[model samples]
Target: MASLAAGASFAIQLFARVGATGTTLLRVGFASLLLIAFWRPWRVRWTGRQLLGVALFGLTLGGMNLTFYLSLRTIPLGVAIAIELLGPLAVAVTFSRRVHDFAWIAMAVAGIALLLPLGGFARTLDPVGLGWALAAGALWAGYIVVGQKVARGHPGPALGLGLLVGALIALPFGVAVAGANLLTPAMLGAGLALAVLSSAVPYSLEMYALRRLPPQTFGVLLSLEPVMGALSGWLFLHQRLAPIQWLAIGCVVIASCGVAAGAAGRAPEPVVGPEPP
Candidate 1:
C-alpha cells in the first residue's frame, strides 16, 4: 500500500518537468545511499557468483523502474499496472502443477485481452505505452528470478548494493535528460520523499513482514498492489478508469488471489523486496 501511494506520486513528479529517467535515478540513488549508510554493504565479502547475482538483480530492477515510468508517461496508472502485472503472474504459474491454476491464468488472459485496445477499443490506448508496460513486465520477471538468487545472501547489504548498481545504471540518463532541473530544491525534496515512501519505508516494513508472515499470507497481501495502485492514482492523480477497465483490473486481481491461495501448500518462493515504484 505504501508503494502504491508512492507510485501515484510519480505522476506528480512527471508533471513537475522531471523526466522519468531523472525520477528513477533519484528514487534508486537516494534509497541506495540510505541503505548503504545503514547496512554498510561493503563489509560483506562476496564470491564471484554472488557479485554477479547482485549485478543481474540490479539490472532487472533498473529496467523495471525505467520502463514502468516510461509507460506511465502515456498510459493511465491503473492500466499500466494491470498490464505490468502479467510478469509476476507468469512467474507464479510456472511453478504450479494444479489443473485449477490454468483457470486463473485464463482469467488474467481475459483481463489483458480487454485492455489490449483491439477492435472497437483499438483507439483507446497508446501502443508505445503498452509496449513499455510489456517491457517492464518482462523485467519484473527477471527481477523475481535474480532477486531469489541474491536473497541467498544478506538481505540488507545485498539490497543496498543492488540498489546502488541500479542507481549507477540510471544516473547518466537522468543527468542527460533532466540536467540541472533535477538539482532544483523542489525537485530534490520531492525526490527524497519519493525515495523514502517508495523504497526505504516500504522495504523496511516488507522485511519485517516477511520475518513474521507465512509466504502465502505475504503473497495474498502483495496481490492487492494493483488495486491499491489504482485507488492511489484516482485519489492523488485523478486518473480514472472506465467501467470495463475496472472489470479488467478485477480479473487480474482475482487471478493473483487464486495463485496465492494455490501456492500455500508448497514452500514459498523467496519474497522479492520492495517493489519498483
Candidate 2:
C-alpha cells in the first residue's frame, strides 16, 4: 500500500512534465518490458480464448489507469482513488455468498452519499471528471475479474505476457500526449521507479501477505489504501483534506473493513489486476 501511495504521488508530480496520459503510458509500458524480459513469456503457445481474454485484460488495465490520471487533473488524488476503490470493493461483496456482507455495502453507500451531494451532483461537482473516475472504476473492476481469469487459465508466465499486451495498447497514447520528451533520461528513471513502486513492490509484498492473511483480513487491509493515498499526498504533496472528505474516507474504510472481516479465514480468492496502476 505504501508503494501504491508513492506510485500515485509520483504520478502527479511526474505528470507536470510528461502529462498524465504520457506518464501512465510510460509506467505501464516500462512495466511490461520488465515482465517480458524476466518471464520470457512469448515462448509458450496460447489459445484463441486466452489471447482474447488477455487482450481485454490489457485494454481494461490501460484504460482504467489512463482515465484515473486524467481524473486526477481535476479531483484530488486521494478522492479520485477512494472513489475508484468502489469498483473493487463492490466486486468483493457483490460476488460473495455471505448475507452479512451487505453491511459493507451500506457503509459504502453512506460514504458515496457524503462525497456526492444530497442536493445535486451536477450542480455541486465536476460531472465530467467524476464520470471519468467512474469509467476508470468500472474498468478497474472488470480488470480484476478478467485478470483473475487470465491468471487462472495461464498462470505464472501468462501474467507477464498479458501485461506486455496491455503496455502495447497504451504506447501510442503515451507518445501522442507526452511525445519525444518521454525519452529523456530523467523521466525514464523516475518513470521506471514509479513502475517498480506501482508494480513490483506491491506485487511481491501482497503475495507474501496473502500467505499469512485471510481474505477478510486482506480486504480490511486493502481498505487502508485510500487512507494511505491521502497520507502520502499530505506528507509529500501537501494536499490537505476537508473534514467532510475525511469523514467520507472514514465511512468507506469502515465499510471495507466490515467486508474483509466477514470474509475472514477463507482461502485465497483471486481478484486479480495489473498490480494497481
Candidate 3:
C-alpha cells in the first residue's frame, strides 16, 4: 500500500513534466518492459481464451491508471482515492448475500454524496475530476474481476503480458500529450523510479495477493489505500483536506472495515477464475 501511495506521489511530481496521460504511459510502459524482461511471458504459447482474458485485464488496467491520474489534476490524491475506492467496495458488496451488506453500500454512497458540490459546501470540487475518478473506479472493479481470472495461470507471465497490452493501449495518447518530452534523461530516470515504485513492484504484489484471496476479502483489504493516499498527499504534496472531506474519507474507510469484519468469520470462498491450460 505504501508503495502504491509513493508511486502516486512520484506521479504527481512528474505531472508538470509530462501530462497526466504521459505519466501514465511512462509508468505502464516502463513497468511493462521490466516485467516482460524479467518474466519472459512469451516463452509459452497462449491459447485464444487465455489471450482474450489477459486482453480484458490489460484494457481495464490501462484505463484505470489513465483516468485516476487525470483526476489528480483537480482533486486531491486522497479525495480521489476515496472516491475511486467505490469500485472495489461495490465489488465487495456484490459478492455478499447478507442483508446487512447493504449498510456498507449505503455508507459508501454517503461518502460520495458528501464529496459532491452540494448543500453549499465550504469548497466545491471539480466535477470533471470527479467524473474521471468515477470512471477509474468502474475500471478498477473490472480489473479486480479480470485480474483474478488471469492470475490463476502463470501469474508472472500473465502480469507481464497483460501490462504489455496495457502499454500499447496507452502509447498513442501518451505520445500525443507529451511527445518527445517523455524520452529526456530526467523524465526517463524519474519514470523508471515511478514505474518500479508504482506499477512494477506494487502491481506484482497485488497479483500475488489476488490469486490467494477471495474477491470480497481482496476488495476489503484495498480499503487501506485511501488512508495511504491521504497521508502521501499531505506529506509529499502538501494537500490539505477540508473537514467535510476528512469526514467523507473516514466514512468510506469505516465502511470498508465493516465489510471486512462482517466477512471475517465465514468459511473462505473458493477463488473463482478461469483455469489456465
TM-scores, each model vs. reference? 0.84, 0.83, 0.87
Arranged by TM-score with the best first, the candidates are 3, 1, 2
Error of 2 at 248 (Å): 3.2
lDDT (CA) per prediction: 0.72, 0.71, 0.83
State the lDDT of candidate 3 residue by residue for 188-248, as single tens digits: 9988999899899999999887877768768866877766777787888887777987887
**Weakest 10 consecutive residues of candidate 1 by summed lDDT:** 212-221
lDDT winner among the candidates? 3
**How badly does each model clash, as a count of residue pairs?**
0, 1, 0
Query: Which segments of candidate 1 are over 4 A away from where they belong?
Result: 115-121, 203-223, 269-277
Once fitted onto the true fold, the runs of candidate 3 whose alpha carbons sit more than 4 angstroms away are: 108-124, 241-250, 267-277
Q: Give the TM-score of candidate 3.
A: 0.87
Candidate 3 or 2, higher lDDT: 3
Number of the top TM-score candidate: 3
User: In order, what is each prediction's RMSD in angstroms?
Assistant: 4.2, 4.3, 3.0
Tens-place lDDT per residue, model 2, 104-174, is 76676667556554455346557777888888888877866666566655444555665577677778888
Which scores better on lDDT, 1 or 3? 3
Candidate 2 local Cα displacement, residue 151, angstroms: 2.2
